[model samples]
Target: MTPAQIIQAIEGMEPAMQRAYLEQVKTVVGAATVAEVERLIADEDEDGLVALLSLGALSVFLELARSVFIAGARFEVKAISIPRDLGRFEFDARQPAAEQWVSAKAEEIRANATIDVRAAVREVMGRRRRAVVWPAAQQVQVSATPMVRTPRQSALDLLGRVSAQTGSRSGGVIGLPGNYAQYVLNARAQLLGGNPDEMRKYLQRKRRDRRFDGIVNRAIKAGTPVAQADVDKIAGRYADRLMKTYAEMLSKAEALESFGAGRDQVYEQLIAQGLDRDSVTKTWRDRGDKKVRHTHSVMGGQEVQKDQPFQSPAGALLRYPGDTSLGAGWSERANCRCSAIYKIRRK
Candidate 1:
C-alpha cells in the first residue's frame, strides 16, 4: 500500500490498537523515526511519514534489526543497577517507580505547604484582630456573629468538591471568588501529570543516542557486526544519567505545583472570610537567585489588589505564581518558585 494509504489505515484503528501498532513500529524503526512519522502526519506529509513503514515488505530485515537493537538494549540494562527481567527493553519497570516517588513527594510537599499556609493565615488574622480594638457595643455585636467561622470539616468537604469539579465558577468553597478553587485544582492536576515537553526530550535523547553512530561505523568497517551481547554491554551506559535527570525535573516541577496549590487554597480561604477586596493586596516576591526566570525576577514586589491579576514581564496574567489561570503556558508556570505576599490595609 502507498504511504498515504498506510497512514489512513493506522488512523482508522481504535486508539488502543493504534498505540499498539505504533509501538511495534517503534521497535522496528526506533523512536526517532516514529516521532518523525508523527510530525509528518501532523504536517500532512503523508508520503514522508511512512518512508520507514513502507519497507514492511522486508519484514525479515526489520525483525532482525529489531532483535539486534533489543538485544543490545537488554544487555546494557542488565549491566546497570536496574531490575533484571524487564521483559521488554523499552518498558522499564523503573519508570513507574519514578512516577510513584514523584506522587508521594508531591503529597508530602502539599501537606507541608498546607501547614505553612494555615499558620501564616492565622498569624495575619491574629495580628489584625489584636491591632483593631472595637467599641463595647460593636465588640458585643461582632462577638454575636464572629467572622471566619467556617468549620474546618465543612471547608475541607467543600474543598474536596470544588477540586473535583471541572467547570469554572464565579465563586466556590465558601464563596472564594473568580475560579480560585479551580486554579488550585488545575495546579495540583498538572503537578501529578508531569510535563509532557520534558518527557518528549527524554525520549528524543534515548532514541537519538550517538553511540548508535559508532555501532553503525564499526558494522560498516568490519564485514561482520559486533555480537549482540557485546553491543548490549555498552549500549546502556548512559541510561542512568538520562533517568536521573528526568526524575529530578519531574520531582521539582511536581513539588512546586503542589506547594503553589496549597498557597492558593490559603488565599481562597482568606477571601471567603469576607476581607475587604479593595483593602487586601498581594505582592509578587522572587527568590532573587540567579536561577529565577527573567520574567519573574522583574515581577518582584509587584502588588495588585485582591481582584486584580499580576502581569508578568512576558505579559502573562497570573492569579499567583504557578497559576495556569488566564491560559498561562508551561514556561510561565512550570517549576515556578516565586510567591505572593499578602497584606490587609485596615481602615
Candidate 2:
C-alpha cells in the first residue's frame, strides 16, 4: 500500500490501535521512512501535522492521502511531553517565583532528554559496517614481543601510532610527550623526559635559581650515581598516569550507552556528578557543540572527592550506568567542565 493509505489506516484506527498500527507499518514499510517522518514531525511553521493525525480530525485522512501518493506506508507520530529544563532558570521579566524557577530549571533538565529516535536510527543505518579485529598474525607477534606490556601500554602504543600517522598536534599525542606542559614541567624537574621540541620550549624559559643548570649537571656529572632502574621506573609511572587518565575518561563516556538517555538527561547527570552545568549549556546552545561533545556513563560523579580513596578514574567512570552520547551535543555547553571522551570507529 502507498504511504498515504497507511497514514489513513492509522487515522481510522481507534486510539487503542493507533500505536499498534504504527508499529505494523514500520514492519511493512521498512525503517527508511523514519527519516521522512523526522523531517516532518517537528516542523513548527508548517500546518499541524500532529493535529491532522488526530482520530477525529480529517487531517489524518489528508496525511494518509499524501503518503499514499508517495507509495509509502502510513503511520502516526506521538508528541513526547518531556519535563522543561531548570538550568536556564531566569528571574528576569517573567519573574517566576523561586519554586517556579527551580521547577523550570528541573524541567529544562528533563527536556534535554528529548531525542529524535529517528536520528539514532539514521546513525545506526549509516554506520552499518563490519567489526574490526587485529589480525591473528598481529596478535601472535604482540605475544612474542620481549616486554609483556599491560593493556594500558598497548593502548598507549596504539595511540602513539595513530598520532604519528595522523600528524595530530593535539595535547594527548603519544611520542611528543613534551607537547604537554605538565609532562614538560616534570621533565625540567628531572623526573620525566619528552620530545625534543617540547624539551626545547621548556628550556628556552629562564630556570628558577639555575634549576636547569643543576638538572643538566646532574645528567652529566660523572659518577653522580644515576640508577637506570630508577629512571625506568619513573618514566613508566608517568606513562601509566597518562594512560590511566585517558582510559578512565574514555571508559566513562562509553558507559553512557546503558542509560539510553537523551541529550538533556546526560547534561543533568553529568552536572550533578561535578561537571559545570553552565559550560554544557553554552555549548549546546550554540550551533557547533554537537561535533565536540560525547558521553560516558561512569559509576561515580563529583561526589568522589579528590581526597577520597578511590580506584583509578576508570573505576569512577563505571560508577554510573545510565545513558550518554558522544559528538557535538547540546548538552556540553560552555562552563560545562564535563569531559566527554571517545574514539572513532571506521566502518
Indicate which candidate wins on lDDT. Answer: 1
Model 1 lDDT tens row, 1-347: 12233223222322332233233323433322324433443454433432433313323322332332233233323332322322223323234432343345335433433433333223322322332222343343333332331233112212222112432211111111113323322222222122333223323444235554454345334423333333322222232233233333333343344333333333343444454457667788877789789999999889998668899878898876666547666688654667665566766
> In model 2, which range of ten residues has the least summed lDDT?
72-81
Per-candidate TM-score against the hidden true structure:
0.35, 0.21
Model 1 scores a TM of 0.35
- Which whole-number lDDT from 0 to 100 does residue 3 have in model 2? 24
RMSD of 1: 32.2
Candidate 2 regions with alpha-carbon error over 4 angstroms: 1-217, 220-227, 255-347
Query: What 10-residue stretch in candidate 1 is worst by lDDT?
Result: 169-178
lDDT of 2 by residue, 267-307 (tens): 34334544443343111111124332233222113333211
Best by TM-score: 1
Error of 1 at 193 (Å): 34
Off by over 4 Å in 1: 1-240
